[model samples]
Target: MKRRHFLQLTGATLAAVSLVQTARAAQPPATDAKAFRAMRKYANLSFGRIAYVDRGTGDAALFLHGAPLNSFQWRGAIDLLSPYRRCIAPDFMGLGYSEVPEHQALDARAQLEMLVALLDSLGIRAVDIVASDSGGAVAQLFVAHYPKRVRTLLLTNCDVEPNSPPPGIKPILDMARAGTLADMTAEWLTDRAKARATFGAAVFVNPAQLTDEIIDYYVQPLVSSPLRRSQYERYHLALTPNPLAGIESRLAHSTVPVRIVWGGSDTLFPQTDAAYLDRIFPRSQGVHVIPEAKLFFQEEYPSVIAAEARRVWGMR
Candidate 1:
């Protein structure tokens, strides 16, 4: 049998992690590469121009993506939930098509400020948020710093107060500090098979999901120039000093409804974080743990994200 989808409070954390792994078919979900490209628009904020997709209309739902990834990660969720909310997915500066000054500070705090500026540019007052990976760290900071601007939060596999930048990421961080991560990934451009293999092990549950087109879409711009490569390295280095530190009290005090949908099998973030997140936030709905999903499972399981998001927002 396939993994039975489940959601429960932090109380049943152990049982939830013990659930059987899901069977993931190998086909990458069909993404309209052309449509996503055509829809891209830039918001000229104080920092720089941020590339984002603003779709549908209603209360806004801001989707924040992870490191080594950009707004493109949320395409599926936007596709599924846009009709119910104004889905806004922005590529963090230094990632995706977003352009920032070469001297821009690339850190969670910087990202939080950029978000404020982005929302200001759009004349938005508040947002319902869905964030993954490093983006989750930024989301937490956003809540602590600007609690009034958020309505609800949905977090996928990512950093938490106690486990920010999970230990497994050390190697990548080391590579980034050595100024070699971008160069290492640049090889993916010539070796699509290698790209799929690396991402399959790290992010995707199904290797076949990474097609050549997806590889090109994700990697080309990342290493297209020396500046982008430097920014890529800087992006990873900014996670240090534990950005989520000192915000535990603020997060604990927040009234924003929070939900954690984590990938139990993700090597970078431990399964316990789902419970930690559940325990930290007073308004936590629960933690939904997918045993077989990897770090970037939102790309693999957008429906799960959409359902949890709708549930949080009370969408029909």
Candidate 2:
């Protein structure tokens, strides 16, 4: 071939390659980090600096996560629901990305206090709460104490009066007290295989969904330092039935609309508790059961969570 022809062919090939590269670059990153990093915000509460995600606009939907996990648990649900309303997921003090000291006690009440302060900082008067596990306990306290501040309550597989620190997790508490839980947690954080075999397999219906990046997101804070591990232990040791007991009577009379989302396969918290809750909160719309799920069903079925939230909150 002639030199001129060869040069023309090379230039055309280079241009095509450049275009392909540009298109690939323009495609959005597939991870939750790519979608949510920009929404990160912080509220410097009395307890510590609380990291939270504030996304979209309109009325607020406050998301509270359970122990050993943080606002990261709600990312999938938030991503699904943010377009219709403001979504706020906070990192409980001593967990997630929050800037907190190790020794502070993070019982249900302290968590509740931090939550209220964070809400005040954001100037949010009321919210529709979607919570799970220990977060469900915290949500119950929030709605019961500050009835006016809550428009709706959504709870799934949470601690209730007489069942706080459900039986299935008792061994974990023993481990935490024995000083082995943190080390084991640290091991899981570094090893995806261990994380899947232990915590991930037990909690998630589909353990394969727990990606390495997401595992890092959940475990990084807990294993960040010795202080963090101590903080986690302290938080667990502080758990009791007292907080739920204090608010039990009040929940029955609460005028706020409530909904119970239960994981049917959850051996830890029985389905009977769902009925118990429905009876306590006469205002409850009724329980919605997800049969294939265990503990963290919200992660797997975020669309259902979003749908029920919209229906209850009167958001289309």
Candidate 3:
């Protein structure tokens, strides 16, 4: 498998990128109200209709988001990186606007399979992967099973083997099992105030950063219907089992460069997990810990993600 070592951007490749920009000026805005609603697309993969956002033109950069959240989670990151890579953000089968069959298995392995099919459908063979939260767990699975498919990986606060389903997530997990997670999320959709007070505050550092549009984008689809609500519960419940189990050896031997950008304030995934990743990945690019940040810092800190992405892609 050929790796993306564009240590220096060639003039020929630059010309092609420039040509595309000239052909189609002003790509659709990704970080705005109409995102995931107006500009979103759907791919008819094996699982079902997979929702996604495709922007720019070049090599693909796949962005996988956390649970309860969809492709909207990466709007900020995509906004910055799209100019360089054809940024692709897909909502997993059970979450977001993806219309999945009720019978479809909503688990780690299933999610990985869906991604493979989705990429194949998109005619993209390889990608630079940027993943967050539970999406990070699925990203690990993708790297373990399909190592060559990934040129580079950028992971934010998420699950690692040592604490696969982090202790802090127990409450959410419990809510899922009791079938109350969906209702709670529905309430969040109905009462944005309650959501602003709890859900936003739990995931983000400053609750105010999670605007009404964000809350609506993240929560509405999850509980828009009975099927969506049930799938929402199942999605969280699937994480109860350690998804990253036994992949340590495969990851340790992986030649794919991985960068761990963790948040200091997220108790769900401690710094020790970051150290674990650094020790495990043979080509680990080192860790970047942002103080006072929380789990969804990827949304809050796009510049950090963009800079690191450029570094990993050898664009800088």
Work out how many backbone clashes candidate 2 has.
Answer: 0
User: Relative to the true structure, how large is the alpha-carbon lDDT of every model?
Assistant: 0.84, 0.78, 0.83
Candidate 1 accuracy as lDDT: 0.84
Model 1: how far residue 163 lies from native, Å: 1.4
Candidate 3, which segments miss by more than 4 Å at Cα? 1-30
> What does candidate 1's lDDT look like per residue over 1-316, in tens digits?
1122133453434443332122233323534777898899999887888899999999999999997888888888888788899999999988899988899999999999999999988989999999999999999999999999999999998898888778888988999999999998889889888888886567888878777877777887789899999998999899897999888999889999887888888888887887777777888877777878899989878777777787678662
Model 3, position 179, has a per-residue lDDT of 88
lDDT per residue for candidate 3 within 175-217, as digits (tens), equals 9889898888888766888887987788787788777888888
Task: Note the residue pairs that clash in candidate 1.
Answer: none
TM-score of each: 0.91, 0.87, 0.89
Pairs clashing in candidate 3?
A: none
TM-score of 1: 0.91
Question: lDDT (0-100) at residue 218 of candidate 3?
Answer: 83
Candidate 2: give the clashing pairs: none
List, in order, the clash count of every candidate structure: 0, 0, 0
Q: What's the ranking of the predictions by lDDT, best on top?
A: 1, 3, 2
